[model samples]
Target: MQEAAGAAGEISEFAGPSEEEELQRQARAVAQPDETEALNWTMKKFRFPLERLLNYRRSRLAGEQARLEKLLAEQAGLEQRRAALEREERMVNESLRRLPVISSEQLAAIASFRRFAASEAVRLAAEIHAAAGRVAAQRDAVLSARREVEVLEKLRERRLHDWRREVDQETERQTAELVVARWALSRESG
Candidate 1:
């Protein structure tokens, strides 16, 4: 339960400031008209505070994907090697069947080759199994890393959206103020 709470806390921290916090900040700004006047109603650039963390997560995800690619390559190589071994074994068997008057020495040599091929086949099978296992584990690791990156990306997108909304509201407020000032000026001068 403690671990779950800790995880939740971590996720919330990544989620950026709460709406209440944003409202409090806006209230403070409204209470201080001097600060707003000094800025001339220019919108500040949107900057995500956790940009570095997001970059780090993206790099980690890239590394995990690279590892997965390497594991897959290794698995493919093992499979190709096993296929080559099977082809050689089939060729040897075909040659033996064609030999009608084979001498004892030839028979012994053929048997030795067959035994070696069988042992090698077993070894290759074991290697292929191990390689497949490694590939599967690496795939899982890549998936985990991808998920982390996606979470951060989603948070970043959400924050950007909020910033845009705030900018729009500020723009509307400034427009209304300007329209009111223009109307008052026309009424007095006319």
Candidate 2:
């Protein structure tokens, strides 16, 4: 009986493998299974790489958004400058408009033969005519400058509109690319 009990103790101590070891072996078997075997998995199972791709896309989108914001800021500044210039031009035009109109009768009287015999009168008339000519030339110059300002303002507005449209298009394209990449990555991961 002593010998048999010693033999039983030895049998119990001769463990083949632990439960933990068996489980580890089974896990390895499943992990390295046949490549042709289909895995009943979902996209959620491989979210790490998919999430990384999405983050990259988000970063790219952020850069584009920043660029667009900068463009918008520049456009706003240009518009503000244009507005200030327009205000200044309007003030100048208002001042010009308030000036008295020269009458035909005044011009004819200034050029009349009665003043020809008097050297002083003739000199005064000539001076008055020169002053009128100078005023007319100044008015023309102001009108020409105002027209140029208007043309430049219109060009700026057109360029801003075009830039806005381009930014919007780029944003949309990035969004589409992000969506497509996410879908493709998810499919590949699954």
Candidate 3:
């Protein structure tokens, strides 16, 4: 267990979000207004290097989500238009089927109207298809942004835990050394 702990400490040093890095991160936070406010108000006692990255990632994720929502809204509009066009086409086709033996000019006018409705329906269907594709792509982008933020957050948590462990281990080591030295001094005096 002791060997494992020592090895873990050594690994943490190499994998470092080291104490100096944490201090530098806090120092840099002085330049950011948001960070300064959070520093002043929050319960957090220290800053980590990943804090800046996390903030940037969070903003990026928000932007991605907003983009996705906009694309979805546009897609919904296209879908509504397509449905309306299809309904109009059906109504026109039904009217043409019922109006038997009308004047040649009247029949030609109804046929022209039906053709226009079909053309519009085709155009809207194409637009809806393209908009659906864009929405899918935007959704993927949102998911990617979320994944990036989540990874950074998890990394920050791990680094914080390692830092705390390092601090506790150092405190324990110092206390043990002090106790051993005191024991030696008392034994020699005795």
TM-score of each: 0.77, 0.34, 0.60
lDDT of 3 by residue, 113-153 (tens): 77887788788788888988988998898899999999998
Model 1, 1-190: lDDT tens digits are: 9999999999999998898667555544444446657577778999999999999999999999988898889889888988998898889888888988889998899889889888988998999899888888888988898999899999999999999999999889877765665565555447
For every model shown, the clashing-pair count is 0, 0, 0
Please state the error at residue 128 of candidate 1 in Å.
1.2
lDDT scores in order: 0.84, 0.55, 0.77
Among all windows of ten consecutive residues in candidate 3, which has the lowest summed lDDT? 24-33
List the candidate numbers ranked by lDDT, top first.
Answer: 1, 3, 2
Candidate 2 local lDDT, 98-121, one digit each (tens):
758757875575445234325544
lDDT of 1 at 24: 52
Tell me how far the alpha carbon of residue 140 in candidate 2 is from the true structure, in angstroms, after superposition: 0.8
Clashing pairs in 2: none
Model 3 CA deviation exceeding 4 Å by range: 1-44, 95-101, 170-190
Give the winner by lDDT: 2 or 3: 3
Supply the global lDDT for candidate 1. 0.84
Candidate 3 residue pairs in clash (backbone atoms < 3 Å): none
**Candidate number of the best TM-score:** 1
